[model samples]
Target chain A: MDADVEAARPWVAEASPTFITLIDQNHLLSSLYNMVNVPQAVWIDEQGRVVRPTETGGSIDILREFDPEAGAFKPEAMARAGAAKALYMEAVEDWARNGADSRFAYDPDAARQRVSRQTPETMLAHAKFQLGRHLASLGRVVEAEALFTECRELHPDSWNIFRETTEKMDTGIAAGEAFWGKVMGLGEKQYYASIDMDGMP
Target chain B: MTIVLTETSNSECVAAPSTTDLWLDADAVTAATGWTLKPEGFCKDDICVPTPADAENYVADGKVNVASFWRLMDRPAAASKDGDVWFLGEGATERNDALLSLEAPDFTLPDFSGKLHSLTDFRRQRVLLITWASW
Candidate 1:
């Protein structure tokens, strides 16, 4: 979900997927599902319910390999970027064919268990984010910036908020210096939350 | 009391007066959220919950204390420094229920052509929703 629709449309057209591709300028999906990062995913059954909450969707921060100064990845350092993606892609195909019977799909209890529980802080963070975004839409940049900064502080795990807020404010380079700052700041913490499918290493 | 303008994901609410206690007049409550105050409590459609037993704490003069109402509805609320912008967030219990039902929370979004699409429109078929951004 990006505010800049025209900028991203060309790339999406180039891919030319058969499925429907929609733009979420309001970040509705992320807010509804409590998603904190892009390249994350959720599976839904025919009934229109979420079977998977949020998975890292094979993004392993290859962006980190890009030196902000050089603006490119170090040679050979990007090898494993989509390493697990092939496996996940295969699983989706199986799911399409087998429906809920696919081993990749989670059952009701398990699926419910997997959905992230919203906390007081998370809810409040979202509130701050909404208010900030509204102000930004109204061109109240200074006010929006303050609320967005508060949103990031309240929900540090929400890289979506952090990245989007930083990008909107034209603060630091969100994809470059800002990205590395987030990654490096996570000292000893796991950047990606582990997925539970078999044959995933 | 100062009137604070507010808007939600879809609708603009009646300009509710600012109250440190979150006491919104009856009209503001309906406009801010679809739920309407009833004898039982605040309700929308078939779902209803009892308002707090202490009537004086909730109903005073003509305003209803929405903060107390929100607690019963299980919503979390926030507003800007001036309270001009208010957001009442979805509660945990309701989100949990949607998960248990295994029904995907449907949304309407626009395509490159600006045509709207709803997830429910694709129902009767499985969907693999992969979220990505140009960032």
Candidate 2:
């Protein structure tokens, strides 16, 4: 994607069209606008105010089912996507009808307030997840594994968090069981020693 | 309150209590950019200005020069180097001044495929920026 963007830059610049293409990598705009997932969009007016809440944007063709041989893919995911698409289409229609003065337009203050409600716990989980990724990148697998586990515990509903935690644990277990084995060994030792001591007593 | 002054080329660094009636470290500004520091103010991005003696200096230099600040903070300066340019300060957890209501730090980073993107890209369009990871 980076290469694609870079490759497209010259053409984008050469054309220098009236349309502007702004990129957001750190998700500052996403967070401020309360965007929760990819392909989501929020419309901002010329005055730097969010005219629309975060919603899925772009055209989407809803798929009701998939190839059965591909394994068990939940139908709920498709349902959710369909719902999201409907909401986004509605949002776009609203924007088209009203522009900046649309009835559905979001108040800047209200939008900010909504964003502020993104609980500290959510932010902490985000932080922990990031730290876990950082640690994993640095080869601190054990620490990263622990952090990812904590992140999942903190944000159980975050699919990415859960997936990452499971993946890290699986990889760690497969590549090196010493860490987990040591923990298990400690537990076993404590259990047997306690039982033996109790029996003697 | 102890004001830690760390001076470096391109900017002055000052760490003091936040005066915005909000939780924010005085170090956030300096850590973001390698500005020279003094009681009066700090300098960065070739902009030298004074800060409120009693107020938290969010950006003594109005424009955020992410590259310079990252170098000053001893963090990776380039997005390519760090994968993500904005790193939540390690000091945030420990410091009473850690920002709570402060706006998110401005940064540019690559997408999943390592594509560099900036906030300005989606400025005209309503953007639903979602931060998700493979976990």
DockQ for every prediction shown: 0.59, 0.13
Q: What is the lDDT of residue A32 in candidate 1?
A: 72
Deviating ranges (above 4 Å) for candidate 2: A1-41, A53-84, A93-98, A109-113, A168-201, B1-106, B111-115, B121-135
Q: Given candidate 2, what's the lDDT at residue A15?
A: 65
Error of 1 at B86 (Å): 1.9
DockQ of 1: 0.59
Which residue pairs of candidate 1 clash? A48-B103, A48-B104, A49-B102, A49-B103, A49-B104
| Correct interface contacts retained, every candidate | 0.72, 0.13
TM-score on alpha carbons, each prediction = 0.85, 0.44
Taken over the whole model, the C-alpha lDDT of each candidate is: 0.71, 0.40
What C-alpha lDDT does candidate 1 achieve relative to the native structure? 0.71
Best by TM-score: 1
**Model 1 clashing-pair count:** 5
Q: Write the per-residue lDDT of candidate 2 for residues A44-163, one digit (tens) a residue.
A: 554335544444344232222334486544566566556655665565577666676655565655544433234444445555555555545557778767766776566543433443
